[model samples]
Target chain A: MSDAAGDPRVMLRCERLSVRRGRREVVHDVSAELRAGEIIALLGPNGAGKSTLLDALAGALPAAQGRIERRGRVAVALQSPDLARRTVLANVVLALAWWGVPRGNRAPRAREALRAIGAEHLAARPAATLSGGERRRVHLARAIAVRPDILLLDEPFAGLDAEVRASLLEDALSALRSATRATLVVVHDRAEAWALADRLLILIDGRLVATGPPRELLEQPPSLEVAHFLGFDGRLDDGLEVVLTRPAHVALDPAGPVHGRVTRAIPLEDGVRLELELEHGRLYTVAPLPAPGPGDDVRVRLEGGVRFPRFEASAPVPSTAP
Target chain B: MRLIWDELGKALPMIFHGNPQLLDVIWFTVQVAVVATAAATLIGLPIGLALALGRFRGRNLLRALANASLALPPVLVGVFLFILFSPAAPLGFLHLIWTRRVVFIAQTILALPFVVALSAAAIQALAPGLLAQARLLGAGRLQVSMLALREARIGVIAALIAALGTSLAEVAAVALLGGNIYGYDQTLASATLYEVGGGYYADAVAIGIVLIVLILILMCGLGVLQQQGNGIRMRFRSAA
Candidate 1:
């Protein structure tokens, strides 16, 4: 992995922490460190204990085992933007007021936070009246307004228009670039993590499968489990499955060794994106001009010299789920 | 209909004259309702919020008991409190027997279930993240409770209206516990009952009219509170 974290001022560190929900443990012996000025994306499948870990780190959930040390104030933008039953400005102001910011200093600072996220126009609107994207921005504004030393964002981009998601991603990236805080985000896919994260942590069944910079992890995933998670569905010449590290890895070649029937062909600025239905499932490939149209037989191939990396846990962990 | 009209014709003059006894009964009714509601709020809101948010072995059973208590007979609660407050009973030290205080206890007991049940439901309907957000923002336990209550103001207001309605209109509890003594424990509801039992039709009708009017006024005030308290709920509905 690309160094558990590049620069280590370990703002928040969890050493062998296990979190329990009722009698069952969701995160078991998960240890990691989030350093200052680093953006780490946590990726996992459903019920993979990602949220359990986040909640434990936020100190909202109890850690049944081990210890977590948090050096600074934490700002959590929860999955659901639960604004108070108040005006938008009041929602942001309440967060500041609760954190001991002087009453007189709250509104202006809240407005500044909203202004920072370009959501100042929403300050007067009732928080309940906002749409999904507006709620996300208002929540982000509230969290960013605190200027917290640690930011824990759980699915902050879950429900938003594509363009809005892109813009929010850009804003988050820019904010991270300019700020000196540690951020841990939970996102859906590797592409999203690749865009906004300095490092990616892959968790599966309450165990850490891999950790590293997003691109490096994808290029040389530490485990076959993580390789499949990175969407490898393609087979190499030696008959082993591997992921196409980037869209640039795909190309249409008449002499290409790999073959599949084109199911869909859509045009883009660079080239046409072809969806090929393989034996196992669907495979998405990008083709330049002389691109195969729908119903055309195509020979597609991943760039040569892709190696499968293996990541093994210290001790075998028996996975469980409901 | 003719009986109502005849009663109104005879009672209108007494109402217009602003009979002191009738005014006293009305004032007593308001006092009992307000006191009972306030007491119930003090007793039930915390219990309700606790039941809704707490995780313990018997929490579900306690919540079920609170909800089922809403279906309890007011007269039965009155009887239970009556025995408890009786001179021979264990709780006889306070000597609240046959007084407004005894009636106050009964009314509060009657209202407690509605307050607890509705408050719990309201707190439960809250977006699950509210408490977490508050805590993460450096709010202490008390702050979390206060903020959660404020966020649940709309539901709590509805709970108050319901409890007040029951406390205001209930006669059996007050009649059994307060003994309906004139110029003392006699509330509008009990006074109306006493006038009817004594065949004083005009006085009963007059008290009934005052009761209805008072209910209308209280309902109007509750309506205003509901509208103001539910601004956030209304916005959410509109947005949806």
Candidate 2:
């Protein structure tokens, strides 16, 4: 996963970046770098300042106290897909023109970008008449047409259905792969981060808490908050060891050491979800169906779990910008 | 009632056959209106966009000033310009009084507030992120403004139409500034006022009828253009 990030080319570097919205400092003391040909996924809960960080990095918002060095141009596909009332091709071409592409090259570059995202058929259509999915594709094309050195996408797959999201994710990632030197994308779904991102930067409460490969961080989350966000339902402390429990890591086995009584057995499309009452606390894990009923005894074997130390969340530092 | 019908009977032939004097007045009115409207559009669009999107101090004050100017009395505007262009005044050195240029200036002044206010309103109604998105796409200040104007074009067209209407219907300002000269600068609206004051009821009615017909034809033409734009947008909307 670090193969792309290990490249020696640095596209953008920011040091101690702090951003303010009105009087509140939304992004605080963030230092990171985007190397060429790497995809870094920004993950956080709602109101965790993901979009604010992206805006500051894109130079759309003024940094309250930091310096950002960029090697070349940056382009962004914003969350709302703010398109002008023009033809789809014209919208992409307009972006190219703004990036200083020559008039002779704008149309062909725009069309090629649209084709990359499977939106070539919509070139002649008016932007105002596009559907939600079509608008997203056009916006991606607009961002990709310029071949920017750094690309920022703010929830590009938000408000999309599963089928459309899957299809667009595939097409958009492939299109973006060839267009930018480095990419920073904000994503909510962990699977999306795993699928597209070579590395993940987890932000919690306006502070960058962890940065590593998705699987590496998932295996050993340094803090309790990261574990909880990564689908660890609860901690199992049985007086001997403290272990975090996630649904995918627990299984039912008669010879297993951990013991709990089933409180609720809820059937799911793939399996049955069982609520178990352990000696220390209650835990939730999905088990095979037709095995666990309410009040039934179960022994579950855990695999690939880690102990996370309890730590306090960092407080936002006061901005020192005059 | 009998006099009204007799005047209408006399005005009909003049209106139908295009009286030379009436034709000259119509042409002057049209030239002034079109030029004033075009000039107002050029100057008002950027100011209007700034008023909508700028976030500096005293923006609200400027917006309020633009809105309040809509109700300004045309005759008061005429009086102000008259004083400014008087022989003893500061601007009297140019000696532009009672000329077609003064008429053009007065009409533009009268129509400017409509364009600015309505254009600002149109821009404000757009999605807030449109401007920010343009910025994210690497547009400079001028290109961002151009994109904003393109996105809010419908509202801008309406603003132009409103400014044109305001200019076409102006009489007191044209009369005060141009002096309603007989053969040189008299518009249809000012000529109607002059005929009525001289008790030439037939001529006044004829000129008034011509003004209404001219306004109707021009408004209809502009209306068709506006509708064609809307229809093209709707055609794509429904086809999708």
Q: What would the TM-scores of all predictions be?
A: 0.88, 0.90
Fold similarity of candidate 1's chain A to the true chain A, as a TM-score: 0.82
Q: Chain A vs. true chain A, TM-score per candidate?
A: 0.82, 0.89
In candidate 1, stretches whose alpha carbon ends up further than 4 angstroms from where it belongs are A1-8, A239-247, A255-284, A288-295, A299-305, A309-322, B232-240
Q: Candidate 1 local accuracy as lDDT?
A: 0.80
Best by DockQ: 2
lDDT of 2 by residue, B1-240 (tens): 999999999999988896787788888899999999999988998799899888899999999999999999999999999999989999999898999999999999988999999889988888877678777776788887766666676777788888898888889998998999988999888898899999999999999888888889888877776777654652222000
Candidate 1 C-alpha lDDT tens digits along A222-314: 655676687755433223333333345556677876677898889998889888755543567777776878898877665632344223322
Per-residue lDDT value at B164 in model 1 = 92
The CAPRI-style docking tier of model 1 reads acceptable
TM-score of chain B of 1: 0.92
**Model 2: runs farther than 4 Å from truth?**
A1-8, A178-180, A253-268, A288-299, A309-322, B1-6, B182-184, B231-240
As a whole number from 0 to 100, the lDDT of residue A189 in candidate 2 is: 83
Give DockQ per model, in order: 0.46, 0.47
In candidate 2, the residue pairs with backbone N, CA or C atoms under 3 Å apart (3 or more residues apart, or in different chains) clash, namely none
lDDT of 2: 0.83
